[model samples]
Target: MKVAIYTLGCKVNQYETQAMEQELRRRGHQVVAFEEAADVYVVNSCSVTAVSDRKSRQMLYRVRREHPQAVLALCGCYSQTHPEDVEKLDVDLIAGTGDRSGFLDLLEQAAAERRHIVALDRSFDHRTFEVLPAGGLESRTRCLLKVEDGCVNFCSYCIIPYARGPVRSLPLDKAAEQAAGLKAAGYREIVLTGIEISSWGQDLKDGKSLIDLLETVAAAAPGVRLRLGSLEPRTVTEDFCRRAAALPDLCPQFHLSLQSGCDETLRRMNRKYDTARYLQSVELLNRFFDRPAVTTDLITGFPEETEAEFEQTLAFIRACGFARMHIFPYSIRPGTPAAKMRQVPKSVKEERAHRAAAVAAELRKNYLEGCVGATYPVLFEQPKEDWFFGHAPNYAEVLVKGTDLHNEIRPVTITSTDGEFLYGTIKE
Candidate 1:
């Protein structure tokens, strides 16, 4: 069978899609591109926002229309949260966030019988983490190791908590074992990703935390560069920072989630931390690591967000000086609490997003300028035009003029920046 998968949303979705692809290939099925003809088409959907849900529907509709004869499957957050909507589509098989292996089994069964199958379980009933393969295809230099799944943080703007349920973590030993395997497989970097990595070990009842898991994985993969996914600001304490800083192979880049920097907006959003706590996390990372790249997410024009509140957010981001930022205009997600609140005008939302983006651009430029003249060991990934491109430990994209530098970690002395990427030369 020829199976093609189209993934949407966050890195966890990407990781799950890769795992499914590997499983299909292992079963002697050919995995094809979404644009190509196939016997089965899987749309791993995302419902983080209404726009994300729309895109998932668009992809599913497109695949169904283009390939009328193929078996269409819908899974992930969108289907998990809104199965009724997904059922209206011409999909042949439907599975929620859990049980990818079983979903594939149903796919085979549906293909054989030409029948419709729906397999979904209550999200809250889930207690164990679904362990999948850790790496991508052999050609990739970096792979993601999902150390945890699910979220209990029911922020007012999020639908993920309901879609993903409570935290269920991959055991420490299993994570270490996977890290060792990924290292042996010649992966240059292994990223620790999840729905909420900060909540790892909560379900284990072992009194261990994310830092413990990090130390274990670092020991398991001595030479592999370890990168982390988006973290809750509360996770960055003195103990966490100190232990994490001790890991020699850990990348000095942290992505702390900060939706709004204003205290009142944060209160309405039900965020666990305020601007002061978020700033402390940034400061702690900077103090522990040498100019560590601190990245964040910002939502502009949230429901009832006053102009003064937006200004406060801008000021707060400037104070933190993020290395990079993902700024979004607030979009109403139907099931989320923020959707029911007094809404901001769409024009105002977009305008605020533009302003926030301008600030983000300035901060990024400043951070990049600060990188000049510093030397970093860059892990080369691919070549473009006349240069091989890779990322430093700080996750800065660095380009050096070379050929066949893929998968090689070479010390690169930064010479300049074109305001977007760092141009450097290999320190032979």
Candidate 2:
């Protein structure tokens, strides 16, 4: 059989799609491009927001229209949360978030028997972590290793917890083994990804923390740089900062998840930390690493968010001085508690988002300017017009005129800044 996969949403979904492709190939099936004729088309969906859900539906419709004879298989968060909606579509196979191996078996069976298959388990029913391949289809230089899955925080605006169930972690020994394997396979970097990686090792009986897991993996992959996924503020203690800074191979870029900047709004959102705690986390990272890139996600207009609250958020973020930011307007999802509350007007949401974006742009320019005359090690990914583009250890984009820089990490001395990226030449 020929298989084609279309993935939407987070890195975890991408990782799963790659795993499915690997399994299909292992079973003597061919994986092809989505545009070409294929025996099966898989849609790895996301349901982080209503927009993601709509996009998932749109992709499904497009696939069915283009390849009417191909068997359509649906999996991931969207189908896990709204299986009924997916069932109404003309899909031949249906699956929830977990069970990739089983889902692949069903897809193969459906192709052979010419029948429909619906196999979905309850979210919380899963107890063990399903190990899958780590490398992605795009690049062999960087891979995402998912050591943890699921979130128990139950943030009001998120539907992931219910879709992914309780926390299931890969054992520390297994994680170390995987890191070693990735290093042996010629990957220069590995991103530790999960639904909430900060909550790793919570379900274990040995009482090891995320820091312990990090230590194990870092030690195993001494040659490759280990980049972390989004982290909760609570994980930013003095000890975590000190220990993480001591590791020579760990990347100095941190993405701390922050939805709102006001205390009352955070309370309504059921966030465990206040503005003060979040600021503490930011300060800790800055103190530990030399000009580390601190990135974040911010939602502008949450339910019942007043003008004063939004102002407070704006001021708070400015105080943090984030190096990189992604600002978004809130959207309603039917199953989340946030959907039932009084929503701010869409115009107001967009307005705040624009304002936040302007501030974000200014901060990014300032960060880039600070990078002038600095030397960094950059791993080139690809080439473009008159230059090869790559990212520094701090996750800053660096463009230099060069050839054959792919997969090679070289010293780059940044000479100038274009307000968006640092222009540099490789140090011979």
Query: Pick by lDDT: which candidate is best?
Result: 1
Model 2: lDDT of residue 216:
96
How big is the positional error of residue 309 in model 2, measured in Å on the Cα after superposition?
0.7
Off by over 4 Å in 2: none
Candidate 1 lDDT over 1-428, as tens digits, reads: 99999999999999999999989989999999988899999999999998999999999889878899999999999988998888898999989999889989999999999999989778888899999998988889999999999999899999998888889999988998999999999998999999999999999998999999999999999999999999999999999999999999999999999999999999999999999999999999999999999999999889999999999999999999999999999989898889999999999999999999999999999999999999999999999888899999999999999999989999999999977899999998
What does candidate 2 score on TM? Answer: 0.98
lDDT tens digits, residue span 1-428, model 2: 89999999998888888888878888999999888899999989999998999999999999989988889988999999998888999999899998899998898898888798888789989788998877755456788998999999999999999899999998988999988988888889999999999999888868888889999999999979889999999999999999999999889999999989999999989999999999999999999999998899999899999999999999998989888999999999889999999999999999999999999899899988999999999988899899999889988999999998888999999999877888998898
Worst 10 residues of 2 by lDDT: 133-142
Clashing residue pairs, candidate 2?
A: none
TM-score of each: 0.99, 0.98
